[model samples]
Target: MSFQLFGLPVARGVAIGRALLVSSSRVDVAHYYIEPAQIEAEIQRLRMARDAVVEELETLQRELPGDAPAELSALLDVHVMLLQDELLGAATKQWIAERHYNAEWALSAQLEVLARQFDEMEDEYLRERKADLEQVVERLLLVLSEGGGGRGRAGGLPQLSAATGDNPLILVANDISPADMLGFRRSVFTGFVTDVGGPTSHTAIVARSLNIPAVVGAREASRLIRQDDWIVIDGDAGLVIVDPSPIVLEEYRFRQRSGELERERLGRLRHTPAVTLDGEPVELLANIELQSDAEAAIAAGAQGVGLFRTEFLFMNRNGELPGEEEQFEAYRGAVMAMQGLPVTIRTVDVGADKPLDRLSIHELRQEQGLNPALGLRAIRWSLSEPSMFRQQLRAILRASAHGPVRLLIPMLAHESEIRLTLEMIDRAKQQLREAGLAYGEVQVGAMIEVPAAALMVEAFLDRFDFLAIGTNDLVQYTLAIDRADEAVAHLYDPWHPAVLHLLHHIIRAARKRGKSVCVCGEIAGDIDFTEVLLAMGLRSFSMHPSQIPALKQKVLRTDTRRCSVLRPARGVPD
Candidate 1:
């Protein structure tokens, strides 16, 4: 069988061999209905589905071929772990139990909730993670209904299939989840093309991690692509050509060869230092959310952990608040895993798009005002809830005893906020001291996420130990653009003169006071802007651990003095 599918470009250079075309026919189930109370039974039913998958994963692991591909084994490990991950399982169970929804319905409803929240997120990168979550849920549901006995094996049972020779199989899906990507047996899969997902999607991340050529945003690839069809996936150009002609195949083959050569050249850069043309050194650090990400950073040659988001700890089972000790353990592990490298943990900046289960949605809406970007959030929220602040502060302080730790107060618009945060830190330190607990002397810093904070950098230069520019929020707030609204996503440009001006001023202020300035935003990871940022006197950049290698490559090629020639539209320095 032969067919073609195409959409916006995503991955490039796809390997091809035997392909598996999964066909799904949508069912409009209006007649097969259950009672309202039956929803309760359905809740139990969904848990059974989860249990079934978990058991299937275990059974398959024990049954797979002794020579199963390493990629497939890695994928299996992720699936097994995902079946047990507290976040996904708990969220799924909650939706089913509380709403009496079917497994699919529960997954869909949870996606809707996360999508809505992410839709309100001010950070484009963080906001994009919602898509990853959606893809994961979608994959899980597919395996639940269609996969035989848990594995998506052809026999509806645990089985291992290998692609003949080195021909890569094309992966087609409506949405490929992280677990699905992890479950992929590398020998059977050469490239990936999906109907839903973006560059920031989990599928894309996995593809990139494995150096597999992939293409995404192929709206009809899942519906059109059949097993064993010749397909070309161009990642750099973001194109997918289905059932490519002989000439097209030849061209792409040449491109693939060229790409491999280029990649080898870039690979050698891993050993190079991120120095400029003038030989000035720049520190490239990785941003992380979990301990699992640390290894990736180290492998990528990142100097240290730059931004450690701490909100994951606060998000509890079924959206409830996690205990203080639970938060401490999470922070402690991340700090110690860094092996004494400085890890700056940004305090929970939940608000607007990200709601805390402890607070009512309505109350949050009110406190956030008409504009969330301009509303009560980050340090403001922590200031209002002293107890919450104290708990986190204490955990961070205690973790400092294990490794180098720094506390970053987000959305610091006024000096008073910094003072209050400092006061809270003191209280936490005092309490720990009185209780005879050992804690390290942690550095206190502030996030320049607000416009007021950006312009008033000089006022705050001496007030904090360090400054991290949160370009995502700072740009959104500065331009009065709601980044989460796809309708206006185009307007949320990080290169806007206004944003550049703010960054210039903030960096200048920090340099004047001899305080370290780092940017923990998406822009920091942009390979194209590495030179521009270096010229602007940026000493450090914090981004996803996955981005470390490429950014480091950029840094090593840049000349700090050459980058300095670039000037901001506003705030002309004397």
Candidate 2:
């Protein structure tokens, strides 16, 4: 009997031929342990493999069709960059040489160390890159054991489908990395299932991008499916079927077709403006970490860039500060990519989530506090490290010469912090003037993440050029719920009366002060609430590039007045 598993709805395409079935198996945790000599050997092996992959990629670049997708080239470049990452290579080697342990043990130990590093990063995208790092390490280790050389593919489930026909749906053991997900042939594959992954996991992102039905954290969905078992997948609901009854199969076929038609309908709006029914205009901007992401956003029809996370430049790095030139390049790239659209780059918001180890090591900062989010981080961390903060500000000032750019300082709680930050910006501008460097008049803004920042909105509006409400932290702090904790994630509701009350106040404050207020949190991307946000007099929102089109379409259909008519219920006040 055959079974089917569902995944995130990426969209739909015709099934080619065969599908890949994943079976679950267990191994002891000790098997992942790494030792010293093993680490050294693994590094050596990885270097050699990296070299070979680089050469092959260069060759492909030279010979490939000029019109070939740039993503192919980008994939190869990412491989080269990973191999060159000193932290991954050096850190692993250090453990091996110092501890003299086996390769598996050493790698395992190093992974924990890497995880700690990831946990300290403030940028969500960069923080998520830990998944990529973990996947890379796994692949490198497998290569060494298999006696293969030169960037071999990931090992786990077999690729069961053929190119001539549709590919089989795939199921995986754990969360799939972006690289592995990118390698899937969308036309051949139907859908996928995994034993591990969450809504925000890389696998989910990939599944969404590819428009495939995917089910994650199925425990042992792989074990339940047999080879060649005819199955159906429902991506929207994240459901799966094992030897599904005839009725269910028929239902899925109808759903699959209807889903495809609906997407086709939505596809038309990809290039259209996201105006609302009553002629309310909403600005849809993209949130990005890497410069390359800007291109993706533009392709998706974003008006401009918002929430350019600058932390990726600092991650997996050994230096206390990224060089001014490097920062300028990153900033300039983003500005130019937007083709004159406003780019708001959040200054380095290092806190418990994003920790600079070298700086922390030298500063002797300890994560001993009971609550890390409230501990020294974001603006607090910057205030602690003046030199590091200055370097970033200087870079942004220089990069501003290229295009419209704004600096958004995160986690502002007190009026003094904003005053101090502006003072530093003045000093930076003065220093640049003295040095005869050309720069632009840049806008300074603050992220309203803390309740203190929210309460002092009028003061902040008076001080800053703009305000971007970070609902994630605002909701978390207000509800006293750590959204990271799964047990309490449910409680971290944005729709809650308290959260709505806070949000309304912030918007009203911004408007009263005649300053622009935009939402850069996940809430902004929600189709369900786009109207509500606009109704609340919020005309600007920044979200992931993929979210821009839908939000835009929602905006074009919604009338500002109609949306505003709906007031907050009794518990919530507008």
Q: TM-score of every model?
A: 0.63, 0.65
Those runs of model 1 whose alpha carbons end farther than 4 Å from true positions after fitting are 1-235, 238-267, 352-376, 568-574
Superposed by TM-score, candidate 2 places the C-alpha of residue 544 at a distance from the truth, in angstroms, of 1.5
lDDT of 1 by residue, 219-293 (tens): 777555544456777777667677777777888788888877866666666667777668777888887766566
- Model 1 lDDT, residue 366, Cα: 60
TM-score leader: 2
Candidate 1 lowest-lDDT run of ten: 25-34
| Candidate 2 segments exceeding 4 Å error | 1-148, 152-235, 238-264, 318-321, 351-370
Q: lDDT of all predictions, in order shown?
A: 0.66, 0.67
